[model samples]
Target: MQQQPPTSPDVSSAAKSPLFQSSTQYRNWRFSVEQLKATRAALNQASVAAIRNTFESDSPGSSSDVHFLDANEEHLLVKLYIIKISQLCGHFRFPEEVEATGITYLKRFYLKNTVMDWHPKNVMLTALYLATKTTNHPISLESYTANIPRTNASDVLDLEFLVAQSLAFEFAVWHAHRALWGIWLDIQDLPQAPPHEELQRIHDTAMQHIRTSRLTDVELIYPPSQIALACLSLAHPEIAAFWARSKNADTALEAIESIKRTITRDGDTPSVDVVREIDRHLKICKNPEKVVGSKAYLAKRAREEKEAELKRKKKAENVRKATEQGNPFGEVLVGQANLDDDD
Candidate 1:
């Protein structure tokens, strides 16, 4: 039997409203830790099989010595590209929505597609460009790509549809910053609320935590409000406790701590040395079909062309035989008009 769909990383303690239950994010993208690992491992295995096939077809024994990247290594390279997405957002002065959504898109794309077929560098650029539009921070195609050293409009535009498709066209994202704003407002109206300066400090710190949480899987496994609450918990436990008690402490705290553990455990970026080694191996083992001018690609192309030529010749010969046998489709002789015309 097929494996059961992955459950959420943590069973969310908070309740969901009808509206949230209807959302694509709620219905589609969430995954447990083991599920995510299994998904990546399966994708890596399929890609490695294809890579080996390509090499074996091109020249026997070539793939026997190539070192293929494992699932964890693929993730490290994607992580390196995730950092680059942040720098692109900063350079363009984009809001947090664009940055966060861009990062999410890049991550989700790799979930559906392996990096060996499409490198994250190209996909990251396209994901950010798609993010600018999906988040309502549109930039013209020309202006969007003008600053990059060797990039043009097509470079990003070509991959836009691919990235969107991989995301299942779920462009609406409920970000943590928005949820934090709601909490920030609610905190001020509480009875005997903290001083304005202290509240502001707390919100700022919570915002920092929210940003860090973007690098983790908390967003996928939890809703925005829960993630915001968790960020608040990280920023100041007492304030978070007060806010939770003012609302409903039991359910809120459970979610807050669950998110906290995930954020704290997996929030760090992977080491560059690890990623660099993986990228080096990637060059050697990437699918040859995607590499233009590679031996496998050229051989595959030549075979296709030869097949097309033979098919064309076969079609023409059949037509010639049909005409020679006086089929209705035979060419008309110029000198012999229709027999009926002689009357």
Candidate 2:
């Protein structure tokens, strides 16, 4: 027999490296700082344009109009929705990974489409549904929608495909939870590691920080490993020394500090009244009924639909007329000539 080539490395080790790789190929979810800024800018611009269009159409000469939600307010609305997503995940008894993935999807979806066009309530549920499927924690549409008030299977399922398409089908989310675990193991291997109980405290605190970090833009601007290290630093001051010893200590510390500031700045949850107001707006967007100006909006939409129907009928009539003028291929191709015929 011919001599065999050099044996390849074991499959286990081969898989391990890729699992930890933070490069673009392994971690497509990672984005540059500029990209994050651009996403926010685009969302703001679209929102302003949409609001202006609505105002212009409603009152053509009104020059004293303001945006419905300024940038800060819009950001607050997004945070509130993420909180709602977490609550839903908890109610369903889903794991932390599912919650993180769902929140990630919700954030990503908003980057491309504003709340005006796509209501976050429906998108939140759809994101959770998609997250469950992607993470191998499958839940049926019926079961998922049963507990959600004023929602049904179609509400979630109908938007599932659209959400996936919006994300470009890149569903591989590397959450900070895994990085937290990896850091914990690294500490365990250190020569001067803390006691088991202390280590557990650190781990639990870091996990909590990771959960809170989900409400910020840290996920989009920083890698999961950095986020995990940052959380660990916050949980245990000693971890700062470990980060300081790393090759990219300066950069890593900057990112960690940045994330810490975000966490600190937004530590206080929105008040119940604020949350209720945001929820009311989201509900109105989802179902315009019972809301002010809904009647005018509905009437305008009806007129537009009627106009569209007339245009469609006129196009069909033109096609029919063309096909009847001795054009052998036109009849079959344009007019469904053989659609009703049976061999």
Best by lDDT: 1
* Ten residues in sequence with the least summed lDDT for candidate 2: 283-292
lDDT of 2 by residue, 150-212 (tens): 998888988889999888798878888888898788787776678999889889999999889
Per residue, candidate 1 scores C-alpha lDDT tens digits across 162-271 of: 89999999988778889899988999998857899988999999998898788777777788888999999899888788888888765888867889998888778888
How high is the CA lDDT of each candidate model?
0.85, 0.75
Q: What TM-score does each of the candidates earn?
A: 0.81, 0.74
CA error at residue 169 for candidate 1, angstroms: 1.8
The collision pairs in model 1 are: none
Off by over 4 Å in 2: 1-38, 58-67, 243-251, 275-343
lDDT of 1: 0.85
Q: In model 1, where is the ten-residue run with the lowest total lDDT?
A: 334-343
